[model samples]
Target: MKPKCISKLKITGTKRILQISLPSRKCKSIRVSPLESRLNTGCANSPKNSSSPLRNEQNNQKFISRYIARVLAKPEFQNKKRPIKTAATHRRTNSDGSKEPLSARNNKLSGGKSSCKNSDSDEKTIKKGLGIPNPDIQKTICRELSKKKLYKTNDTDEIIREKLIEAITLSFKTTNSAPNTSIDFYKLGKQIGNGAFGKVSLAQNRLTGHKVAIKIIDKSFIKDERTRRKIFQEVFIMKKLNHRNIIRLLEVFESNKNVMIVLEYAGGGDLLQIIKARGRLTEDECRGIFYQLIEAVKACHNMGIIHRDIKLDNILLTSDYTDIKLCDFGVSRFAKAGEKVDEQCGTPAYLAPEIIADLGYEPFYVDIWSMGVLLYAMLSASVPFKAKNLHDLHKLILRGKYDVPEYFSAEASDLLNKMLNPVPHMRISLEDMKLHAWYNGFVPENILDLSFNVTRQNEILSKMMSYGFPRDYVIQSLNLKDVNHASATYSLLDLESSYNYT
Candidate 1:
């Protein structure tokens, strides 16, 4: 025979003991005998081996309590108060002083005036009324109810409604602790690319159904604590940068054996692949791509960041090939004005003469020199300072021995010469490069304006969304800025802070 359903349950007194109300035999559709009903309602039968229905129900409750206890043990819920119990009685006396049934008592609990003043206190009272073992356990139980999409006041069941409120509030305590769960949230696809650091694969978010690139790095390859710290620093820096011409870091997941970084999927591949396919680009085409690259570099500098390794391979193209994103900050560094970096990092073909000199060099100057080499490669399909060995390459770079192809425009050669000057102090600054005669008519005047440029506005919006801001709210914030006065001179942090987004 099926067990009779519970009619009502409530918590009573300061200790918050659970009180249950069993169905009355006088009610309609009584399936069991009055003795059976009374036996089932009171307690389980005392049998050594026999299974009783009431015993099963008690076991289920205990199972739930154990699960809740496990969830409560999480550090986030440690200091939370125990679920408050409502001062609800088993029965209410009517106008004639007659005690109402379990159904009427449930109605009173569900729809009657709440004794608490605020929603927080009401939630506490409901949790107490449910007789949850502790606050943490109560929070976990509520989250489960919320995931099931339970409605508090709308649900006819009082027990379910109380559980829903508890869950909705518990979800507000979001944590940034390294996730201990499996990577089941992402549906990994076929491998798309690979590098010395990691392999990139296409993956889809199981929740949002959005496609992204996942870079999975092997922890064993990191070798030292310094390298591990750099990996974390890269993640931290990328999270702060929000630019249209820079790849977005969507999320990071780390495990004992590997680290996974989710990024914007650039389907058109890197500029190197495109260059290899097309051999060389026309001057106009080169001008457009070069303009975007400079703008990206300018943005990075404004934020006090230096992309130590700036090469054709580090620049990725969007699917349509109309724009490029500067990525791979593995060797990048944060620099203050006038600070010098001594590291001899970056690809050999693109390393600046100052970097090859083994002397401390300003990172910004090294970046400028690298951009010159990149520009040369884009127009000529070959690196300017090529040699048979590192020794020969260093000698050639030190001598500043690079011949500009005659086919290149005079304006391009002039800018390249200024940028590739062997003396770091003589290298062209980013501000000067923007106003060069070559880019005067080719690039837009407001290309670097974050507020006026639609691409930049969209990039800022995308970043704010990643930070959990609503889309409408981000749009409203962006629209409030004065477009004409906002310049690329402002750092991303400065612009974002101006709008009070943090």
Candidate 2:
């Protein structure tokens, strides 16, 4: 029989609380309360160490709890231990029909090695049984573990590493805290990435089992009313905007200092990653990606939301390279019908001439100008307006005088010139962009039959992994001193002239 939250089971001679991880794999072991107690503390009492059975059991439980905490907290362990709960712990029975030793399970987990054999328990067991007797201890352990689960760890470097390992072991000791597939709604899995604000985790929806990304933002960094309001506005904007080409926001969860924003996880990572791996994106691929992006931007314009920060970094790719999703709405603004925005905020490299001039202009035009910059970056794997200092960059942007590279096609050049027009009134509108020659026949004839070659995608991903865009485009363009190459003489003008427009 499987463990339940309130179920009583006899393990050896003790009647213990058995809780199964509901809706999880059957082969997974159910943690008794005794085990939970052990994992909470670092020490586990072994047969060699414990003089009496009662004392031994207590030590073992404590050790196990600490061990669990260590394992669950690790990056690698987080991947192995999922949060889903299932009714069956389909323990493989030997011909003799005896239960398998814990070592066997531990070996499997450690890939055939007993790495954590010796441990001390949090509480001394009364006898050789898997049971919980003291209600007070049980309640304490349960509350603490749940609290830890709820609170995202904000430990330092060394502490994070140690705690992760302990957490993994603790996870298996009790099933009460197991993430319910039905209740959790989303299959919360491993931590994919982290940033200054918080982390991005991979999650799967229980209903569809589709992998998604969950970004948990730390509340500590969001200190002021400006930030709180910004977060709320972002959530509101994401809730309203819906498009295939845009990074779809599924849900927003506000818990403590952790604000979890659930989104469609892009397995292929971000365009910036792709570009970093590859010196430059292929012309055809760039065209297709830009075409989709413009359409998405047009949709945003139609919805009255201005994605102020449009760049390669904000674009994420699907597992297959066929689709790209625009993400990171931190600087996005919602304009009321017939209203325009003058707030100047966005990435410096992608800011429009009007923004540089500090002149009030329709925010949508700023988006269009940024789109042009994005296109240039996609095609050449470098920003068009590059300089050493912000002052020079601002001057260049105000002039809007970067020469289009010779590698650019006629159609791309024309589109670039039109979209990047310095005058806000002259920039292409969302309506006109859709009707442009470059995008005229780009719409899908059938949504489901979109062409996506897996082989090509693999090649692209592989190439991206090894090579992409240049990292120091801004630094290099300005001819700044490379910290490592103080004595090396490099000519910036010569390098620029090498790729001069005909």
Best by TM-score: 1
- Which lDDT tens digits does candidate 1 get at residues 123-154? 34333322223325434443343234444335
For every model shown, what is its TM-score relative to the native structure?
Answer: 0.56, 0.52
Best by lDDT: 1
Which regions of candidate 2 are displaced past 4 Å? 1-190, 206-208, 337-340, 439-443, 449-502
Residue 18 in candidate 2 has what lDDT?
18
TM-score of 1: 0.56
lDDT of 1: 0.51
The per-prediction tally of clashing pairs is: 5, 68
lDDT of 2 by residue, 1-502 (tens): 1111112222342111211112232311111112111110000001121233222222244543453344334454223431111111211110001011111112234344322221111113211111212335444443454344422347443454344334423533443221111113344777766544666677664323456677777789777644455565565566556666777555444555576666656566665555544546555556567767766777786776777667666777655455667776655656543344334555566767655443345556677788887778777767777766655665566656788889887877877876766555455555555556665444432223224445433433342222221224223422432111100101111211222312
